[model samples]
Target: MKANPISPTIPLDAEGVHHGHLRLPYSRDDSAWGSVMIPICIVRNGSGPTALLTGGNHGDEYEGPLALFDLARSLDARALSGTVIVVPAMNYPAFRVGTRTSPIDKNNMNRSFPGKSDGTVTQKIADYFHRELLPRADIVLDFHSGGKTLDFLPFCAGHLLPDKAQEAKVFAAVRAFGAPWSMQMTEIDAVGMYDTAAEEMGKVFVTTELGGGGTSRAETVRIARRGVDNLLKHAGILRGAPEILPTRWLEMPDGCFCFAEEDGMIETTVDLGEKVEAGSVVARIWPIGRTGSEPHEIKANISGILVARHFPGLVQSGDCASVVATMAD
Candidate 1:
């Protein structure tokens, strides 16, 4: 792969607190040679472990960026034994516009990892993180929530990696985050995700899905903030014990367990954290502008708790309606 053109204003290895930007050149009608400046904060002290914290992968998800912004502003270099690299908005273009994909190229940043330097704008950003940012970390936390299209129960999740040893380490951090729920999940699509890139490099990675609807709640934001602090402490970069909390372990074994089948108005019958049974009606969709038509019911394929649901009142044929999670070992 070719070298990325995105350049950071500060050295990632340098000591002390540095606030800067990841500059990516852009050519537009208004400015022929202007660049998009993605904000970054790095706090470095002596050597222990480098924990990379990132948020705003999708523009509409606000909890990650909000929590990370506060974290970056309040974090002090003198309080750390290692390094804390923070990027509050990974997708600057999309973040600015409050959209799921970049406005410049309409590409999803999370699905564009290990990206090509010569690719589209979004891919270039991903390429830089893949080549430049990710290699400098011992652990990675990429925060996420369902954006405009869906909403989720507050939970921090760890993927089931092929390497059990790595998976164990990641799960420890996930559990340490101490969200209400700790989840072991298998991604429906993991092709070029940043999580996949980090995990593939053997880095311990923990991600989250807080409340969503293209917005955030105060409680979920608090959860995100505390989770970050807990993760830092767990990684030994910060000098403190993690807040102990009893986290309910859950798992999403199959992607087909929750999804919508037709375009209509969705009426969810189950709420997040509510226990559901297999074959139970999770949601029902009313046909668009069709009277006397029976509503189509969406059912839960597996028995567990309803952990996620569609956000908008209306639904497309293929939108995911709800995700049920079962107990995990």
Candidate 2:
């Protein structure tokens, strides 16, 4: 493989506060020698574990980016024991346009992990993270929210990995994040996911769905800000102990998701964080083509709490409407 075209302006190993960009050259219609400059901040001190904290994996999600950018501006290198790499917006183009995927290649950033060196713009960014950034970190915390298409109860999460010890460490970080809920998350698909990439390297990883609707709230952002500090403390990268909070543990099992069966106006009976029983109607899709037509009812396959749901009013066939998750005992 050829060397990656992306170059960083700041040294990744320097001890002190440094800020710069990951410059990737892109020759487009506007300019023959144009480049995308993604903002990054590095804060380092003495010897300790590195915590690579990132946000804006998807463009529309704001909680992660909001908190991370604040931390980058306010964090003092003298108060740290190790390095903290902050990339508030991982998909800069997508974040600039406030979309889920990159505008340049229409590829989702999270799904472009372990990417090719010579590929699309999104892929190139992923390739750099896979090669340059992730290797230097002992722990990684990526933030996420519902974005425009979905909504979620504020929660920090980790997957059920095959490595028990690694999973334990990941879960410990998840709990230390101190969100309202701690989830054992299972993605519908995990191919090329950033979480997978970090975990495969045996790095302790945690992610979050703080809140959503293509926007963020004061409470959620507060959770995000505090969570990052908690994680650094948990990793021993910071001096203070994590601020402990009560968090309900939850898990999403297979068949717990409800999907729309037809296109129409969506009517959701259950709200987020609400309880529902198996076979209960979680949502309904009324036919837009005509009146007096029976709406397609989306029912819960298992009894659990409604952790997430589609955010918009309209629904299309095969779109996920609701996700019911059980209490993780």
CA lDDT of every candidate: 0.92, 0.94
lDDT by residue (1-329, candidate 1, tens digit) is 57788988998889999999999999898899999999999999998899999999999999999999999999998889999999999998999999999999999998998898999999999999888889999999999999998888899999998999999999999999999999998787999999999999999999999989999999999999999999999999998999999999999876435777888999999988999998989999999887999999998898989999999999998888898988887
- Segments of candidate 2 deviating more than 4 angstroms: none
User: What is the clash tally of candidate 2?
Assistant: 1
Worst 10 residues of 1 by lDDT: 253-262
Model 2: per-residue lDDT, tens digit, 1-329? Answer: 88999999999899999999999999999989999999999999988889999999999999999999999999998888999999999999999999999999999999999998999999999999999999999999999999998999899999999999999999999999999999999998899999999999999989999888899999999999999999999999988999999999999988877888788999889988999999999998888887889988888999999999989999778888999999998
Candidate 2: pairs in clash: 147-214
Q: Candidate 1: list runs displaced more than 4 Å.
A: none
